[model samples]
Target: MDRETRYEDSHVSIGSFVLESGEELPHVELAYERVGPSDAPVILVCHALTGNQFTIGEDEPGWWKGLIGKGKYVDTSEFQIVTFNVLGGCNGSTGPCSINPTTGLAYQADFPFISVRDMVHSQKQALEQLGIHHLHAVIGGSLGGMQVLEWGILYPECMDHLVPLAVTPSLSAYGIAYNSISRFAITKDPEWKEGYYNLEKPPAAGLATARMIGMISYRTDDMFQKKFGRKVKGNPGESHTETTYDVESYLHYQGNKLVGRFDANSYLYLLKAMDMHDISRGRDSIAKAAKLIQPNVLAISFKGDLIYPPHELEKMFSLESMAHFYIVDTKFGHDGFLVEFDKWGPLIKQQLKETLKI
Candidate 1:
């Protein structure tokens, strides 16, 4: 298969799997990348929304390269690192864009909705199939952070440490509003054709608009002001200037870049999964859920993260003795946990060393 059609590292069939919604997928293929020696300590790096299995590579720089290098937080020289595309992702995973083995057609709109719990459970099964029964740590940020929490709560005995960054126990109403608007933008595009359009004619305009909306939420107003201010992309003296603000140009560039790689349907599915993340769903309260986590937990909050501000993560303190929390001061907002490695990397290194006794 072409590189674009499947992951270049490794791919495996997960066989039949059922989602939390009772929808069954006849087959699920997971594309993943594993690094270092198999007998070494295992570190599972869960990706954020739109992220794939390529966490660290030589061909192209990865999204978390600064935090995953040789002597970085994960310390690839000492630990085996594993990462994979989410079940409903387009990057070498089964999703709406993948062919339905039963029908010989793309699942498209027929692909059932999935929740964060479903994603965690599916990953657990996949790891078991790969002969990985335990992990030294599970680390993630943003949506990936939610998965970290889910893994701790769902399979407490499977991991020794859990590091969740820039995420809360559940989605806030404000966060939901941002995600809803992004989804609506995609569905409104005429080319969407109710999610049945061919890949060649997919809703590019709508998906681009959706990405622009997501980009706005990912960064803070202070970050925007500091980075762009009133700067104009070109000569504002031109009477017919099509663009005036540098922020506008940045958002457009980010949107176009994502449109070229991501599938609109996968975007909707993953966002919905993020919205459905709730560690305390049936546990009655956040405190009760925290009690079930057996591993050492580190919760990292970003100062300007409007989506999951430090206050939102205060609930994690209920874990009491097992939990440690830290806030990184930055103007990067929710994306700070991804970009401001200088601020949080030391903490990660310290904690990983303390937890694993490295």
Candidate 2:
């Protein structure tokens, strides 16, 4: 299938900056797109892990399609929606897939390790380039939500409202363990070749396997049970030669779909960024970080989300003063925020209206 027509592409140049590993990154580029009228108040929508600027709307049905439109929850009639592929993302942004000026090839393993803070900093540069001095709201889910939290802490004066959905203040030990294993699966693949695989013959198998592992964590067991259960196929009496559990089929489809569009090296880089996310790191405490964000904060959690559970969200709320917490009771797990957009959309609209004074 042809890639969907993207929102208008734009870029910003970030000056030299030192990474957490003490590597100097000079002239980083941030690729972004904006929808609605430029005169409207800016609402920056950060995409989740493995997501792109299409978060708001795409030519195809996107994750947040229902939440953004002329008359939709985000109300393009009232707000200018800005979405960007994060700094280390594969989608039209500077990442491992981006050509390295020194070698004149994809950065691959040569890309500097990045943090969520670094991603937000690059986005800030994008916003500045666009002349968006202040934001009406910053909204996102999962890893995108992590960016929202970082924005609130790092640039509280830049935004009036913060909406972090289905996310946590930090990756849990269990979360890190699961991600590490997923990375191991990818890196161990014979085709990976330590991130130096041919561009045309990228490590498809390793990337697909990594995506399959992530699909399990993105949704709830209850959802799988309801949709697949223990039913099996593929034997002599089965329906098809490759048919197995429905969940397996689902994961396979998701994995294959991801490999078609994403780069394995970019996946590894973004995953490492997620692992490095710790709101309290180098700060006084989680509470101190929360205190710095004086905006009206909306922290939404999914009851069935094991990755970033409701309890973790509660802890994050406890660290803040103006946090309004909501648990989206659903069997969709961590992805509930994306799947149940109808329910959360209005809530987001209402909150933004109230907070932005629109």
lDDT of 2 by residue, 1-358 (tens): 2222225666667666566678777657777768776567788998988888875555565567778876788887778888889988887778888888788888898999999998888888778877788999999998899999999999989988999998898998878987898899889888899889888888888889889988898888889899898776455355555657767777888988998999898899889889988899989678777778878888889887888988887887875667888888788999898776776777888788775543
Error of 2 at 129 (Å): 0.8
Residue 204 of model 2, lDDT score: 85
State the lDDT of candidate 1 residue by residue for 1-358, as single tens digits: 1111112378877899998889899888888888765566778889999898889865787778899867686677777788888899999888999998878989999999988888788888888888899999899998899999989999999998899999999988888899999988999999999999889888988899988998888888888888899998777867664866788889888888998999999999999998888888989988788888898888899887888878777767644798899888888888987786878898878777865643
C-alpha TM-score for every candidate: 0.94, 0.93
lDDT scores of the candidates, listed in order: 0.85, 0.83
For all candidates, what are the clash counts? Answer: 0, 0
- The top-ranked prediction according to TM-score is 1
